[model samples]
Target: MDTLAIVILNYNGQSFLAKFLPTVLANAEGYPVYVADSASTDGSVAFVRTHFSAVRLIELPRNEGYAGGYNMALEHIQTHYGGATYYVLPNSDIEVTPGWLDPVMKLLDANPQIAACQPKILSYAERELFEHAGAAGGYVDWLGYVFCRGRVFATFESDQGQYNDNQEIFWATGACLFIRAELFHRVGGFDASFFAHMEEIDLCWRLKRLGYEIWACGQSTVYHVGGGTLHKSNPHKTYLNYRNSLFMLYKNWPADGWLWGKFLLRLILDGVSSLLFLKVGQWRDVLAIIRAHFSFYGRLPHLHRQRKALLKQQKAEVPLYPHSIVWDYFIKGKKTFEAIVETSEK
Candidate 1:
């Protein structure tokens, strides 16, 4: 039997769990539902234990963010139940649809080459609009800028059945990612050092490097509250985004240009982007970008070792947009997915 486990990693998101967990259990009738709580002191563990008798709650000793939380939780699961064939990693804030698992699992089962996939993520507050986290699928530019198929920067497209077709993609959103358990473990799981943010893209990049495809199961859909752990505009999230992005690029090596040179350009562009924050006196954000670069530098030695080890098994060129997403999105005002889709072919 092909056992699939739905593991939701949560960190002090009791409200989200209370709001969405019932729907998850209702929709996921047969499959086992697990809530891996990341040391949430807000009585999340007690709440789950008291209210949700059906959920298999695994309370972590400490908060290790998303990467470490899942790594630890999945390991615990593997030991306890001999593990499932597939794992569905969902953020606590997502409200899953009925039969959400079928299309994604079917796609994965039909294609052994596909290691991971995600359902279409519509905004929980604005149901008609695609969420910014993983709008359709996700893509990274040659400069390591990660964007989604139906989202460019902050622009979230409305779900008009435009991206209903399933297709291969560079990365799946961790907000509700479905991945083969074997492949997930085989890839060493996520880089826990990332803490959170961009870790999914990093994992997908490694799988793609091994000749595995990541996909968007547009047939399945989920509503995400988006940014349960960290709000989109939070400075810490900014730090993680910039720093983990650098971490991802270093670990997965860009398709062109020297890594440092590209990073230098990224630094310049990041500085330029900070002008927006500077205009509004959000110095913490400007400082967050600066801090991200320093963190990247501090981790270089360890990252270099990781790069060498990871590349030892590399088999394929990592897929990335050949153009700079910054230039296209900002300079040229090509704010839509359609405007940039043609660039992939050119």
Candidate 2:
């Protein structure tokens, strides 16, 4: 029988895993389940050992962040697990619904050209609503901002046959993505430079460049408890999001001019945004933006080197028009960071 390896990256997500593991194991029977824990001090490793000894656990020496943790686990899945045809990367905070795995695996089996397939992810807390991070499928804008089909920003719509149609997307959410192990290895897995945020987008972009398609399997579904591990407003999260976004733009743009132009636009927009946040007495958010930019500057040289190497190997045609890949499903308005924070907290 063909084998599958389900890789879950954990970091003090014991509460989430306590509920998620059983459901995943029940649905993902006959597959090798692996948990790559990032040295959680909250008894995450001990809990797994006590309750789910069947799960192959690899405790890291330190917190290597999400991308690094997954990469470490991917290495084990490939080398040790041997016949793992599919590698499913699910966040520790998600619950897999019944019959979800079959559709995802079936789609991959049917379409050999598809490098990855993701299930429809609904919010775990609000069953009807779509999650903020990656609702249905992922898309990228001209300025390198990534969004999804069913939801955008704070405007999440209920998933009621809106994205029922199966289609190819620019990328899939890292929350619950399944890919052919060979294709994943061919793309060198998630870019470790990302550390955490937007790594999936970078991986999917590389897969597309290699002449492979990323599909959204509408039939399969999973529930995502958004921001279960990292709070949405964390400054570290902000830094990674900003830095990795810039890295993605630099690496994927057809030319250097495009990358520079986007960078300038982002800087101007972020500056204005920071000023507005400061005006509204949201000094913390203002500082977050400032710190994000400063962090990006500190890592610019390393990012540039990586971008140069990636661009040198690219032979695929970059889409000239943004609308070709970006579908704007969210409304636009000038909103302060404070407003977003307040709304999310509610």
Candidate 3:
């Protein structure tokens, strides 16, 4: 079995596969590459089969979304390639550079403590800027608000080589995440219920709780065309992001007094976000936020069960940004990551 396997999850991304597959295959020298198709009707599987015949294709029966699709695909990988050390789960809409996997894979190989990591992700269209999904690395605020070293909320920082150092982070962007194969299953893979957005953060949070490090390896890099599957402007993406963020906090945060206070504060922040959406006349987005909260409330029982199961297995402390990222980015006008870090230091 190959020590590493690069698996791209695809839905209806025929164009992306046709365009980016060559770069992926070229950079994936000495590693097995697989495409896990989520039963796309757009002839995505057939195209891959016809053109990239060497690339292994696993066709699922239906579209289970990213979370479920990866879980299912990884399970297949585990069963078949039990000796494989690492799995790279990249989005279909990514373009990799030469030697892109070396730095991150080498880091993981040397450090068993690190369960997962991602390379520096830049924007494909705008090469100078960090990508929204994962700029340098991902981190979360005290209230479960996720942002990256080069991205804070909607504001993205340009690539100035500020985050070049490989460092431990709260989460690795799923856009091009490289994870230790065995540990991925051990921590109980991504929450299938989430189905999509914020699932990577939840998985990383779980890994962190289990005393495993997640990191961003800046020595290697890739470009991502964000919003390939679900565009940022779509209210459905907003809804899933909002609902899943709450679900993540509920399932992972400690059951101590700290939980309720943070949850309430996050709710208030979410309300503020709703108001901002209203100001922009994004009425559907506002309704999406409201619906997200209701969905969170409805799933409390399931989330509680998950929390109980997780807590029973691990009691490690997961790191979160000491300050509120929302306040820092919006109120304090800290746009770039360097600015935020500098402000936090003061």
TM-score of each: 0.97, 0.89, 0.97
Residue 129 lDDT in candidate 1: 93
Mind sharing the TM-score for model 2?
0.89
* Number of the candidate with higher TM-score, 1 or 2: 1
lDDT accuracy of residue 34 in candidate 2: 88
Encode model 2's per-residue lDDT on 88-197: one tens digit a residue.
Answer: 98999998988988877878888898888899989999999888767888877576766676765566778887677678888899999888888787668888878898
Rank by lDDT, descending?
A: 1, 3, 2
Which 10 successive residues of model 3 have the least lDDT summed? 76-85
Clashing pairs in 3: none
Q: Count the backbone clashes (under 3 Å) in each candidate.
A: 0, 0, 0
lDDT of 2: 0.78
The total of clashing pairs for model 3 equals 0
After TM-score superposition, the amount by which residue 90's alpha carbon in candidate 3 deviates from its true location, in angstroms, is 1.1
Instruction: Give each model's whole-structure lDDT.
Output: 0.90, 0.78, 0.90
* Pick by lDDT: 2 or 3, better one: 3
